[model samples]
Target: MLLQLCLLYVTIWLHSVSAQSSSIAKPGCLERCGTQPVPYPFGVGPGCSMERSFEINCNTSFNPPRAFLSILGGEIMGINPTNVRVNMPNLALSTYGQGARILTVVYGLSTTRYTFSDQNWLTAIGCDDMAAVTGLANRSFSGGCVSYCQSAGDSGGVASCPNDSNGFGLGTGCCRTPIPKGTTNLFVNLTDVHRNWRNNKLFSTSYAFVGEMVTSNFSYRLNDLNNATIFLSDNWSAKNTPPVVLDWKIGQQNCDEARRNLTTYACKANSECVNFDTNIVGYLCNCSKGYQGNPYLDPGCQDSDECADNPCDPNADCTNIPGSFICKCRKSYGGDGMKGGSGCTKLPPSTIINVSIDIDYTWASGKTEISSPSDTRPFISDIV
Candidate 1:
């Protein structure tokens, strides 16, 4: 009865696998979203991606083409299943040495799965500029790092440092701070923050944006604004901010809860759902140990041939499984027979064969005996 039940379960599992829909973008469908290669789990146009959440817009009107996030207004630089990097809009408001102009930049986040990464730093530029960046990191957290020059001369100065030096100009003139996790929404306020530091003439020109970590050397000269490129010198433009990282996930619920529903469950066969381990939201789907490729695709993750690495000893046999591999000892060996373990060891030298004979030696009565299979053939009695 138990055996029958096991067979039924196997049949059901196989059926479930066959029923999974194929959503991964294959040939004929739109593959290149702008300059970026939209892999499975993320795609361009309809029916080409895992879902609408992963849809990307390929704007072809541009000369070289460009990919844009459907919800966010930024050029997509690269997209992986787990993380994304983009150059966000460098929305800015500068006086241009004119009247006092205040620029407020607001970035709208559509879902809970993505958040500005800690890998980015909120940076502010300009000598007499004051700026503050605030965001909703699951709460109303305000007051990020502020940037303002201590004095006009402080903004520009000659410097020299070792070529091997690796560090950022945190407090010298421009200021930088970290963005909190779970922050979906972002607002940059160039309000009264920079008012006090402004001079009567074209004194305070400021800019603020989120970008990757900043590093510099002592060769920099602060007084020469044109020479400073790391933070100052007005290098950022309205169309681009420094490279920023974005986190991504696969499912709405925890790993266990998503596993119950086969229809809407994101992970395909031979894949495992992993819950988010950080303050970032949502769960990720990954191929099992010995598999590779998009776990969200039909037929599930593809098998990775681990035996190609010659993982087993020469005397042992290695069998590649769907998501794993196995090793076994050879015919006349005894040991784990693994690649790194004690390999197939030879058997002992002694050969004391035991024999068993079964026959009707007395013409009427026949009896059976048991012994080694190799020795029984040699023990047969001759007809007397």
Candidate 2:
């Protein structure tokens, strides 16, 4: 009977707690842009978002509503309230530097540039190929990769170009280099395009690009040169590009800097403003650990229910508090009863043990004596 009552109480507590902290969008603003959950600080229309940069345009022309970024043009996949993600636009660039014009894929350096995620790899794919991907790096912004292989067979010179189960003449040859933090723009340039191997020289074409880890074939045989066998993941040859993962924010200043500007400061009650570690620039707002929802709305940060998962033992009581919960042991039990904590157990009763005692007698003097075999130990306070 007690267990039933406890469970009922917990259910009510969870519901009430949630009701007090429901996530709310701006007044009269659409909570959703197409099918996407338009969380606060980010909205589809004016007066809905925290700033101009946070605006998302909902295109209803498609079968389902599709959201696109006005500043960073790309189709929206989905947005997580806790951890936000956006896809940066992708473009494949391929051209040979015959004598001077060495060109390849590039991402930023425009009026509107994306912070190329550090996760994206700057890759070079070819035999006798050296590619450089320049961005923000080591006080400046520059990095790259280099690969070399024989035109046909084994001719030991530099590094060995190992092949897998994928047949010969198929140069799955690849070289990798890491993209660092604060990459505002990425420029991929194919260097050493024309190099002599033997009779089979590499005056042809090689590939270099900065993108995600997805592969496809690029048959590089432009005009009379032919002979462009390179395997690059992220499918540089396909016109339909994969989504580029990008971390976005409302402004370029850190939390303290944003707060100083009252008119522009966006985080609401119980919300926290965080600065981007990638660069000392952009910032993001989030509800505090115990809360959830749009931190830009009034009373925006809502309380989270920790008891929804039945975290406490049946012999304990669950109490929902602001930003946290408490699990208390019942009258008949002891110890913390919450999940991961020492659960409630049968209570311990009075305990006694045999021991020696030193005492002063008013009838005589003082004497040290051993306790009787059956004598119960004295109360701690009564001793001495």
- Indicate which candidate wins on lDDT: 1
Which run of 10 residues does model 1 get worst, by summed lDDT? 159-168
lDDT of 1 by residue, 196-295 (tens): 6554422335556766553543233444433223333345342235677887776657777777888988887788888864444468888889887668
lDDT of each: 0.63, 0.60
Could you tell me which residue pairs clash in candidate 2?
Answer: 137-141, 214-234
**What TM-score would every model get versus the actual structure?**
0.67, 0.67
Q: What residue runs in model 1 are displaced by over 4 Å at the alpha carbon?
A: 1-27, 61-64, 111-113, 148-169, 191-203, 214-240, 277-281, 312-317, 327-384
lDDT tens readout by residue for model 2, 268-349: 7888888866444657778898787668777668877878868898889998899988999898799888768888998878
